[model samples]
Target: KWTWSAVFTLQWLGLSIAWLDGAEVLYTYYYPTHIVLVGVTVSLIWRYYGR
Candidate 1:
């Protein structure tokens, strides 16, 4: 849905900006990023199959 897509896109853009700003070591963002990724995946699956 739009909410999930927006969350994913915003997170991706934030990460990309951070990396471009010389934040080569993004160790702190791994857990949050994984959480967002999993959330998006689960949201898609539930939307389609949990009907």
Candidate 2:
């Protein structure tokens, strides 16, 4: 969870920076996919490690 939080924080920061720089279209378009992929990856990792 902590690791995911950190990754998410950095992701948001980077997205904001890029958005301000005018790359809003790409990020907005892929945001959902990006989030889903991250969530799945983290959950899989956590499950594996937890075992």
Q: Give the alpha carbon lDDT tens digit for every residue of 1-51 in model 1.
A: 786787678778867766766555355664467677778778888898888
Worst 10 residues of 2 by lDDT: 25-34
**Candidate with the greatest TM-score versus the true structure:** 2
Position 3, candidate 1: lDDT: 65
lDDT of 2 by residue, 1-51 (tens): 786787778778767766776767547654765687688877989898999
For model 1, the superposed segments whose C-alpha errors exceed 4 Å read: 24-51
User: Which candidate tops lDDT?
Assistant: 2
In model 2, how large is the Cα lDDT of residue 9?
85
